[model samples]
Target: MTADPIDQALFPPFDDAAGFDRIRADLGAFLPAIRAVCERHGLAASGLAAFERGTNVVVSNDAGQIIKLFPPFLRHQFEAERLALGRVHGNVPVATPEILREGELDGWPYLVMSRLPGRTLEEVWPALGGAERAEALARIGEIMTAAHALPTGGLESLDLGWDAFVERQIAGCEGRHRRMRLPERLIAQIPAYLASARPLLPTSVIPVLLTGEYTPENLLVTQTGGAWRVTGMIDFADACLGPAEYDLLGPCLFLAAGSAELQRAFLVACGTGIADADLTPALSRKLMALALLHRYSNLGYQVRIEGWESQASSLSALEQLIWPFPVR
Candidate 1:
């Protein structure tokens, strides 16, 4: 059986980063074909802008809808995202995009979702006062706590059970950091550190749906009553079933940016207690290990961490700098 021309045209091998860049640079070449697909499904394609942060072809249409098209290799992401949005609908306090339509177009899976309200949290973070930033972080913490409290019934469909996922990540922990060109000294210690910490890791717990990327970019905030509040939580493409701590990596490393006050507010809001002593060094180490093992934990891709170069001498130092727990 021959593949359809549209499928053949839209599909690109995942290994070719340059090829993906070329497609993004000249999105016009693919717009006509994408427009045809959207029109066939009764979605207007005008006002399309390629969402630059992601690897896939994601664009927002004039109708206040986001249409994300995934190549064959990334079809799992489409399925995971669709299932996540559906399962979390009406279950949490924050607004989540409603899946309007989902189907395969020329072998490329696409999902049309309602465009969420408010600007992304990252857009407003730099302009906020200390009080506003703290309030926003607390609100985010609350939202995350509520999200993690939801039942994980339908999430198993993603086939990423917690124990298996952790084991897999642990096995590849060293190699992944090595490939990311981590310093030789730190890379050498990763294996022993991870092995020693394996027993400390959670093997069994009530699994919660993990929004693997809980950074500011995925959180939408709006100013109301003279305070910043999280209005919506978007982008669950990397959602998985895992321990609650996994969700905190982004907020700690990226959003809070080593702010003790913000981290305290976040923890207090999450009902994890306000004392710095609450975040024990061992627990901090485990969470730090998980952060390093995160699927997208490549320093080359995370420009935000570049600012900490002077403070971080090794992986351990970097972890301590990003998530400083009081020394006993």
Candidate 2:
């Protein structure tokens, strides 16, 4: 019987440096294959760096070109990113890197893209204080608004409707929860939320531009002259077509100091359709709760499977909130 190529990559003993070394050795067999492709595409001279953080082998060079090798099992994800990038081309709110190469390297799916120009906004956010932070957030709202305004009409294959997005989220929760051996109760609650919140979900989600992962890691802010504008928005790996309100939640949860006022301003700028009066601590409460639930599910799976400890812990902290359940 033949083993699945992706399963092989997935089961690799990836731990710390020693495990990563073995993984790298395994990848070395495919390096030559990738090298040949890069050379053929005239990308031979690109400076190379490998970020062994996530599921894929994320590689980039000095030229700002990135090559993300998706595990054989995640071929669909590779296609999704490529498709989303294509949809946003020339229509993106801010400059986005161009996809240069997309195909398989040996048996692994790989995506090569020209690098966006700028530093991560995460690094910039800390330097600015109250007023500047407020102003930066407003700009952030504008960026999101611009992205949501992109025309989705006549683009069916690329369109990520609300139903599909909700289904994916539910599936994601179920998959991770099962993997982590998380409490069955939490998993059971998801269906209830989905059934009850289905109506509310669409109401909150005004379809515009949906970049699925709105985390700070994917955002790039560049300074031109003395003005700092959002120069590049990278990583369309999770980009989808969905509600604009859902999109603003990223900044609300991860950026914006988790402030109600800032969140209100963001919703307004992004044209999220949520009235200022609707902005309340209640919204933050939901974000905080959902954040924790996701963190627990992700971490539980990671820990149960002996996956990346740091990654699991990172996600665990993402949902930090006052919990009645004691930390075991």
Candidate 3:
């Protein structure tokens, strides 16, 4: 789960009575469609329960795991997903969602994953205060570090060249922008940013540990015996093979929960020494700008046009990601 910049501001309250009612209403309409699919796949007895893990999750006992449904444009994301999950299968101390089946129902493709047992970090984040929050983040850092520590040869091979990768991302953004009916000014900034930034990209490349989405929402924390450990790292649908620096950017935005020191701690845990060159304020700015541009130009536009209230807050978060400095 990557942080939705607009998640907090734009989504309906999930814990509230009204919000749950709305959820049940949507589930009512979707369940039958899902049930039909499950039957086709021979998992009919799988009773489904909705989860609040930053995306729509339906869990069924007989179905083997939870099933995730994203809008159509995201169908292409599954390739990166299977690859990421394969990388983390045993080395990382996390449960990767198992993709049992995938296909479109009512025109939207979905992935059914094996469910892991535990509550989401969101359920406990608020109760945790200063040090406790730090501990939780440390645990998350450790899990992510273990993930990055694993060999990258498999992920590396799937790498689309940087130039082609950027072009595809830009095209995706442009298509979504056109569909969302965004303000022309926002639409116009797309090509201008690409024109300026694409030229500055380095000629070389590096192996990256990519888990495309790395936000608190996608993380599941549970207690084993007495200590807390990261139980699951779900939703790899957007996983990509790109710059090593790119992997840490999302945790810097949402998982650190706005704490610079925590973000530093996470980098340290990953064991990939934080290069002074990469941490320069200018570099952070470049990464942040690219992140926002990518979201607004592509992912953000997808959520807006799809009218998915849960991810609306993601758009707002983009502002924070782009400008971590205090306003003058």
Candidate 4:
């Protein structure tokens, strides 16, 4: 039997120290061969630039299509993204890439998807004023609410069930933070804090599909009638079935950035009334603990939180640091 060409290509584990650098190098070396595969499938590569910002080797062309290639070791991400994009298409207001084709090329799994039109929110956020940012954040909140309301039937087959997933995170909370080099004071409080807050974790609310990273980078924005609005949501590789609050961590921590007004606008749009007391100290602590336990949580990569180090003396202080009350 002949070996698959993709199988013959050397690829590192997902967590290899060199990570995407190694993948990019290998992909560059194999570009001619990859381009041949695309040509065979009627996707022309002339004058097209490949976008390598993410872990995968992705290319888009004038034909309004995105071609994403995943190494065999990262096939799970391919499957998750393909399934998520298909499931969420047309069901939510915000646009999502539609899967046009999916298969393996020389052992590398690939998905060809329709291109979504809009600029990433991160690109436009800095120019917007406070009111404009708030409006966009509130619209994002509404989009998230709609996404969470979608049925989870298609995602049930994913490897980790919600309860077991939370349990795993709970068990690893302390060690995970330690590896991320979280402050010693915060690290020491994790175990007992999580133990006391376990009951408050979203076991009671009906589980919903969480697009784990809702930060500006994953959102697309465009001006509609002179107002900036979120037009599309992308990158479902981290999607999972979890509590809605767990999904809010990205927007709250990254987008709102302790702005009480922005946070209120977001929560109000999500239909969670904006009482200052709603995010009580206990609830805030629980959410912060859960933030640390999030699937992709790592303070090492979240350089924004470094600014709070001087103020995070206690849990209450940490909450204030991450989600301060609005100024009068």
TM-scores for the candidates? 0.88, 0.69, 0.63, 0.87
lDDT (0 to 1) per candidate: 0.74, 0.57, 0.57, 0.73
Instruction: Flag regions of model 4 displaced more than 4 Å.
Output: 1-17, 25-27, 271-277, 303-306, 325-328
| Cα lDDT, model 1, residue 19 | 73
* Candidate 1 ranges beyond 4 A from true positions: 1-18, 271-277, 300-307
lDDT of 1 by residue, 1-328 (tens): 1124564554444456557666753466568656756776788878887777776787887889988777767777887898788878788888999988877767777887899889988898888999888887888788787778877776787645678778788788779988888767777788777877677777776677877656888889877887778889888888877777777778877777666666676766773333556766676677678776777877544525556756676767776776666533
Cα distance off (Å), candidate 2, residue 164: 6.4
Candidate 1: residue 76 Cα off by (Å): 0.6
**Angstrom error at residue 111, model 3:** 3.9
lDDT of 3 by residue, 25-47 (tens): 35554565566556657775456
Q: In candidate 1, which residue pairs clash? A: none
**Residue 284 CA displacement from its true place in model 1, Å:** 1.8
Question: Which candidate's lDDT is highest?
Answer: 1
Worst 10 residues of 1 by lDDT: 1-10
Per-residue lDDT of 14 in model 2: 48
Off by over 4 Å in 3: 1-25, 40-46, 51-64, 69-73, 100-110, 149-160, 167-203, 224-228, 275-279, 295-328
lDDT of 4: 0.73
Model 3 reaches what TM-score against the true structure? 0.63
